[model samples]
Target chain A: MSRRTALAGAVAITALLLQVTVIDRLHLPAGRPDLALVCVVAFALVGGPTYGAVLGFGVGFLADIMPPADHTIGLLALAYAVVGYLAGLVEDVEERSVVTTVLMVGLASAVAVVVFAMIGALLGNAHISLSAVAHSLAATVIYDVVLAPFVVPLVSGAVRHAEPAG
Target chain B: MRDSRRARLVLALLLLTAFTLITLDFRSGGGGPFRTVGNTVFGPIERAVTAVTRPIGSFFASLGHLNSYKSDNAKLRAQNRKLLEELRTSDANRAHLLSLERLDHLAGQAQFRIVAARVVAIGNALDFEWTATIDAGSNDGVRRNQTVINGDGLVGKTLAVGPTTSTIRLGADPEFTAGARLAGTQESGFVDGGGHNPMTFTMLNTRAPLNVGDRLVTAGDTDNHDRPFVPEVPIGRITRVLPTPGQLYRKAVVAPFVDFTSIDIVGVVVAAPRTVPRDSLLPPSPSPTPTPGPGGTGGTGGTGQQSPPPSPGTTSGRRSTSPSPSRTP
Candidate 1:
């Protein structure tokens, strides 16, 4: 448990640093692949459903630190926790299907977006139209979907490493 | 029901947090968070960027060292000699230009030195106001009043300079105004900034022969020169000219040569070129020296100094809009 938490923190922090200093500059204008979200997703997948909630909290808290984010700071924490907790549902599947990975990340991404929008709505963050944000949402969904199949295995392999030497 | 109820509670809390964030953000417009995060988070990132760039810089330095190994010493010597000769020539040419302007404002010129600096920050357009940070400041002899300039024109003047950073107040800033002259005929005017509105250059009579493409240069401080100082350096070129009916002077829209927002590197004029009579700097030279002592003493000693010397009228120092005594074509 201790090892997993440290690994998750390190992986997530590295991705966060790169996202701000580099990926932020690479603003493809379409929504950027939320590397932090992906990292949280990966960690939660490996760490089990309940632990995924904890990882979500970490990632959500990270998002609050950026300049552009508005009120309802804890929305991310709650949203990510739920996303993580759900990832634990299929933790034991040995040979995860590519279709399954794609669907899970896609669904996860949609959930993340909806949660963010909902948070904004609650905060009365002037109702931004979904039409306006569709491109970013599309970009994120596509990126997360494409990344998941490759990422799940890597995440699983990392978790295997976390097991003690026989 | 129990699990659903807990999840709903969590969602409620999240919604509440979002509401609070919105209120804080709406009121602060990201100022508090940006500063806090900039220091805690972005500051480290900037430091890391510096660290990463430092290696590249050092590599370039070594590459420079390696390439210059053979000819560096000889090149330095030759460059030094050339610079010394060029300095002497510039000194003479500057004196000539000063003399021409001296025909207008006769006061001794203020000594200045030039230094080059690089831009570090360009303020965002969305929030506060636009400002730029230059790499040189007090450490480089840049001071508050000394202007920041690029090749095309004045970027702004130094507002504050630190050891490694300096903030420039752009010519377009509302607080800034400079005395300017129409280059073609050296007709003088005062230029004022009005935010995004077209900057204005107002002359007393509105009849100065201003034409499109006419350039403007820094007219030295009139307070110091009772007569408006002859323009020492070009600031910008006229883009639009408006001459009022029945007026003898006109105003023009000036497009500054320096793109204040995009400036990356600039040369600061260390000294305003002063063309004091050449004899003044030389000892016992040809130019008649003003005698020292309160009552202007000299051979004839009729109260020594020339009193009210050829009065041009009281100097009305241009307060940006200052209309002081001035002479030009």
Candidate 2:
């Protein structure tokens, strides 16, 4: 595997571990930020659509299988893959402005939350609530916007540095 | 153009992979290989992470509340002393009123071997979902569908069990339901989890006397051992009762005595048990007290003395009239 791919994989696993462990305990007023979501979005922005989609799958799969996860496996993987691919579309822009990047991350986070609930409802989870989706969307957007600036640029810089010479 | 084509191809492949996984997982029944693999690979890491992060989290939390600690400690100490004195007085009175006989009567009604477990994690990503993970699992004799409780009241039941961990769906989850009944009345019904709101209970009989603040307890029908809920466990108190004019049944909202959010230590009843029948099952019926005369005192003394003796041939009839305080509602 390419160094960039390997690094991304490592980061995804670490993000999953942190998401379920420490980040969960952080306990914000709205709710804890989705660390996996942030990482998926950040990496997607850095690596473009294909890389993001693949990374999102890895990360989502990790979450789906993790202990304490009661939902179906790959439900999150599907939701996040779509988010990563969509977020990666911003890479087509010639000059990706700060507002555009933040907005993209926010939008992706909201889409991920809604899509996840919709799919869960489809699978007979019976616990999905529109109000909960909306609340989670709002919280996710705010968290992503705050997190995107730091996470995306750092991941992008690291990936660029680790790029193999032609 | 080639880069875009390659990206599209990769995206398509990933989506297909995701779809295939979802289909396989759904078809294979809950959890499947993905869950086993995930737990095997990630459970230990998560546990270690928790061990490391907990101390740090507590440290920061302690730091944030350092200013209030001294005053709170002093206040708690004074409160503790006052509570100790109150407890002593209550203990003495309770000994006189509720004797060993009464204690045995209560013990006979609760028929389950319980294993205590500690809450290790709350559902975070799925905050809207009512779920938590406890430290004990199959290794500790914990099993799925076992009823979990705290001192105050019913918490929830075990949803899924891992090797060293098990997930509990809190009673506040929308999917949660338990058979329950009003304490003072034979009226039985099912209590449902409210999912962020107070739980709603629907009584089976329309004419069951409805009242606000009436306590509810489990109506343990263990006929279906698959759902082995013990009988007479206190659930909560009714906050509101809504009886529709045309409807045959009444529905009431219950406020659970146990605080779902703050639950720490909990007990899991491991098996369905039968309570030993009390010797004097029937205490008395709710009848008017006669005028306080010599005859009244004599009648009370007679009943009190004979209470412990098993009245012959009245077993079937007396079973229904037992008025043990613990059994009271």
Candidate 3:
């Protein structure tokens, strides 16, 4: 595996652990931030569509099978993969202003939540409700956006550092 | 252009694989080999991470609640004084009840064989599922569907058991439901979790009288094996009685005794008592006067003063009335 891929994998796992053990326990109002999702977006923006989608799938799969996960396996994988691919489509994302990048992260986070909720509804998940979906979407977007300034730059920078020089 | 096509292909392949896995896992009701492997692999890693990060987690949690600490401290001090007074008075009542129990061997509190466990991990907040992983598992005599409780009251029931850890669906989960009975009247009902909101209790008999401040406890299984919940584990108190005209059942909103958000220490009942506990587990009525009747008899007069209804939005830290001190057994 490439050094960049290994770094991404390590980062994703760390984010997953912290997300479940610490962030989830915070019991923040509305909902907790999706740290793994933000990490995926960061990796995607740095590596482009193909790399982003693959990393998203891997991270999502880990989340699905993570302990205490009662939801269907691969649900997160699907959402993250799609979001990663979409995030990579943003041209010159790294070159964009911090404000623009933050906006993109917010947009991607919102899309991921909507896609997950849509699939959950299709699967006849009994817990799905319009209000709940809206609440989660708002919370995810706000938290991810607030978190983007700190996480996105650090993750993307690490990925860039891990890549071989031209 | 080639890279774009390759990306599309990879995305499609991954999406297909995800969909396939989802179908298989869903059809199998989450008992697929993949899930087992996941439990075997990730369970240990999660346990370790939780142990290492618990201090840090609590630090942040305390920081988050820093604003409430001062007010909470004062409120707790006042509550402590009141509880101390109640304890002194309840001592005589407890002794009296013990004598009565010795007189009538059949009427006494159930003794549970419990395995104490610490909560290691919590379910993802993004997902609507409310579950927590406890450190105790089948290796520690924990089993699937066993009742989980804390000093406060009913926590939840074990869902999936690993060798050293188990997953419990919290009572606040939207899908969670348990049989419940009113503490005094013994009017049986079922409690339904409302996710982030308070639980709802539905009485089986439509004409049964319901009142605010009335407490509810686990009804246990009809077979008395206590598969999921043991009888008389204090569930919650009625906050509001919904007026359901023409409905076959009556519904009431319940504020559970155990706060689902910040549960840490828990006990899993490995073996239930030989006899049903009935209302023995409920916290003593808040009234200062101890009822003269036997523990089995309904004592409505002491608890008649209605506890102010908890606001609909507040879901945690509302344990204004102390639970009974005799719940340790």
Candidate 4:
């Protein structure tokens, strides 16, 4: 991998690591802010879904590992891969603005929640309630959107010279 | 169009994947083979994340250390001030423990073994269910039905065990109901979990006078074994007791002694195993807990008591009858 791409990959993993281990612990409103979602959306909006999807898998794989309990290793990997794929869709358009990135974060956060729930369901973790899933989705969308305006510009502006892998 | 089709196909597959995982996990799918695969794929990534985030972890750890240090300093001064009080309480606890240990010695029970586990995963995705995953599993001798304890009190038991990790349903999981006895009065009841926070402890029979602040402990009797299932494990102090004077039984709410909200370390007790030598004819198998853990009893019966709750929607244990002057057998 090119040095810039490799650095971006490391940064993405760091962001996700901070997420499950620390950011997840923040838990305002009994819900956690999806920092990885914001990061993934930012990258994907600038890089396109294909790049986003691939990055998503990388980040998700790391996230799955850092949980308080990481029994099912790749559960997050699958979930994140999907989220990255969705974020990749944002890259089709030419003009990438901060607003667009924030919007992508909100949307991607929703998708992440849904995918996470769906995967948990498949794994037979019986206690998940439909309502909590919905609320988490709503909460993440709002959190990501709120964070997007600040994070997107910082990431996109800083990474302008750093091109994403296709 | 082709790109869109490919993208749509990927999205569709992801949705399918999410759906499949949700269904399988909810059902608990009997065997946790798939989870092992999930762990394998994600293990490297998790390691990388940890290595990459060590600095961040160190920062947080230092902050936590400072807070705890301050709390400890205050506690030590209080301890000095209450030296006399400490002696009194210490004498009382010593007396209590002396009496209890006598009983244990008489019974020839093994000394308690505590194994520390790392917090690997927290919270079940897709639902409001409150649970966590620990790195210790069948390989760690963590078995199905093993009792898990934290600093505060009993958290829950092991449900699923993989080679390297296991799944534990916190006491607050909606489907969990445990057989518990209020410490002070010996009034036994069934503790049930409803939501994510405080859980409810209900006496099957009516007329047990329960109050806020009443402490709860394990009943220590298993129906099948007639042996003390698990040793004296604390549950929590009663936070609220529902008043139902006219009803057959009364229910009380308890704030768990172990703070499920901020759990970092846990110990799983390898309780009385299931593989109790069904017959002498067969060769001895390793473990008996439904899901085997690393360092688990490995089918060794009579090692320790398990505080494991019922699987899914099932719970076992009959309610104690209305307060009798004497203990019911």
Candidate 5:
């Protein structure tokens, strides 16, 4: 259990750092992938909803409060946690279809983006525009869908391997 | 039901924690414990990552285009030597002109004291426009509202000063504004940021004549009490003008000389030059051997030389925005 927690924390921290420093500068056609969000969703899919929520909150809070982050802290934490918890609830489903996985990630990413936008609006962040948010939401869903296949399996496999078996 | 009930309780608890953090962070305006801890823990790691990856990245990048780099290096070497000779001639001419301008007490030629800094990071993960982080901070004489500029023109103003770093809000940011005047003309106006579009400079008077391709520069009138920006720094060129019928003023789009996207190094105006007040009528008291002080040399030489980065932890003297009457330049 302790080893698993450490692995999760390390993955979360690495993803957060890369998201800000490396990923932000990539300047792809659509946008940068939300590696931090994807990391949380991956862990939750493997470790269950409770673990997902915990990881999302910790990682999101750190990312939000980091320097150069002008938004209100904890806004992403709530959004990511909700997304993670919901994604985790899908672990019990027997149908492990590709379409199901894509739909699940799509829904989770959309929820995260909209929640983040709504919270930003409520907090009176003038930079948030409904049209811009919708645009970003579309781009984010596409990017997350493409990234989910790699990030989810890698993180889940790593975490499960780190866990001590009976 | 029991398992679902536990999951619901967990979700509720996490939500409550998140909201509490938001309230605390909002009230403290980023001075809260969360931000402090986050910065303390992550700042060093970021510095390390940047330090390690930049050199490696550049090496591979250079290798990828070796033949092109070789060709460019040969061409640039000849050009560089020619430019160096021209620079020497210009430097001599500039010194003579500066002396005349000082003797005449030209407000537009006022010298300045500046601290040089390197841009360490660009936009955030969300791709927020017109903001960046620089290596210099309050520790290096950087303070909130100090104007930042590059070799080409004005970039932005320092937004917030951290202990070891500072955030700059670029000219393209929606919140940025500055007073501008047409080059070689007395027509003055205010320029407002237009985000993705070029900034709009509005002439205060409707009758003011504006022509396309006219240069714009900062209206750094100390007498008017403009905060932080040194007078007469280059801004940009007028690309297009909009004249509205019966409107009180005319607006033109200014294409800033500084390319906001590729900014690598910037200078912060730590102190304004000692200027003779514009209203003073007495003939400038001529001191024997008028040696231009540090402020004059540093400010005027900004475009001539790329200063070696300041040693870490070295800080310049802090000066108030109020123009000092010292005989230093």
Candidate 6:
């Protein structure tokens, strides 16, 4: 595998571990920030649609089967795969303004939550109430947006550093 | 253009695989081989991470609650003084004797055999489920469907058990439900977790007398094993009685006694009490006397003897029945 791909994979796994262990335990108001999702979006923005989609699937799969997760497996995988692909399509990552990138991250976070709830509903997961879904959607978007600036640039910089200069 | 097409093809294949995995997992009721393998591989790692980061996590937790520490300290000090005063009074002696009598009655009963465990990690942020992983597992005699409780009250039940770890579904999870009984009345119902909202208790008897502040305890199962919950474990107090003009069952909102967000140490009941503890396990009711003047205090001391002080960290002080002494003449 290419160095960039390997670095992205390593980054994604670290983000997943930190997300479940430290970030989720913080119990931040509204909702905890989704570091793994942010990392996936960052990688997608740096590498494009195909890379983002694959990374998202890998990360989401780990999340689904992770200890303490009782939900149907692949539910997160499906939601995040779509999110990664959509994020990668933001177009001209090098030319995009900071404001645009941050906005896109917020939008992606919101979409990931919504799609997760939607798929949860489809799979007969009764826990997905309308009000709960809406509350989490709002919380996830706000927290992720607040977190995007720090995470996105850091992840993108690392990926770029790993890129082979032409 | 060719690269984009190949990328799209890859996306399609990945999506297809995800869907297939979901189908296989859902059809298997989430107990597929993948789940077992994942637990075996990741459970220890997660446990270690939780152990290493707990101090850091608690540091931030305390930081969040820094504002409440002052008031809490003052309240505790006041309570200590009151308890000390009660100890000196002759009336308090009589009350203590009465509790001893009750304890005598419980002397021959079967005791709960519990496996104590520490919460190692919480559920992931992305999922809506409220669950926590405990460090004890099958090796520690922990099993699926065992009731998990802390000092305050019921926390949740074990969902899945690994060799060295187990996952518990907290009482706040929307999908969680447990049979509950009114403390004094013996009126039975089931409690449902409301996620971010208060738990709901629906009584089986449509016309059962319901009131605010009435406490609930686990009804437990008729079977001797008590597979999921033991009888008489405190659940919560009734918060709001929903107006049901023509409903078949009475519904009320309940605030659970345990703080699901901050669970630290919990015990899994491997063996239940021989005789149901009944309402004896519920926290002592708040003082009945509104104004414990010298004369009134003597008379009310007997009532205090009936129940022991509330368990530490129960937050029952706020729900005391009597108005604060400062407010009384």
Residue B62 lDDT in candidate 4: 24
Cα lDDT tens digits, model 1, B5-74, are 4544544555465456546654665444533542344333433443353323332232223222222233
lDDT of each: 0.52, 0.67, 0.75, 0.57, 0.65, 0.74
The C-alpha RMSD in Å for every predicted model, in order, reads 15.4, 11.5, 12.6, 13.9, 15.4, 11.6
Which has the better lDDT: candidate 1, or candidate 3? 3
Residue B137 lDDT (model 5):
66
Per-candidate interface DockQ score: 0.07, 0.40, 0.61, 0.24, 0.30, 0.61
lDDT of 1: 0.52
A90: Cα error in model 3, Å: 1.4
Best by lDDT: 3
Rank list by lDDT: 3, 6, 2, 5, 4, 1
Fraction of true contacts kept, per model? 0.06, 0.54, 0.63, 0.15, 0.39, 0.66
- What is the docking quality class of candidate 6? medium
Candidate 2 residue B20 C-alpha distance from true site, Å: 2.8
2 versus 4: better lDDT goes to: 2
Residues B137-172 of candidate 6 have per-residue lDDT tens digits of: 777777889988766678899987887778889999
Q: Which stretches in model 5 have alpha-carbon errors above 4 Å?
A: A164-166, B1-3, B30-33, B56-110, B175-214, B219-228, B240-254, B274-329
lDDT (tens digit, per residue) of candidate 4 on B48-113 = 454354333432332222223222223323432343343344454344233222322312222334
- Provide TM-scores for the models: 0.44, 0.73, 0.80, 0.61, 0.69, 0.80
The interface root-mean-square deviation of each model, in the order shown, is: 8.9, 2.8, 2.3, 5.1, 3.1, 2.3
Q: Cα deviation of A107 in candidate 2 (Å)?
A: 0.5
Q: For residues A37-110, what per-residue lDDT tens digits would candidate 2 score against the true structure? A: 87888878767788788888888887888776767788789888888888887765768888888888888888
- How accurate locally is residue B8 in candidate 5, as Cα lDDT from 0 to 100? 65
Better of 1 and 6 by lDDT: 6
lDDT of 5 at A159: 72
* Candidate 3 positional error at A138, Å: 1.3
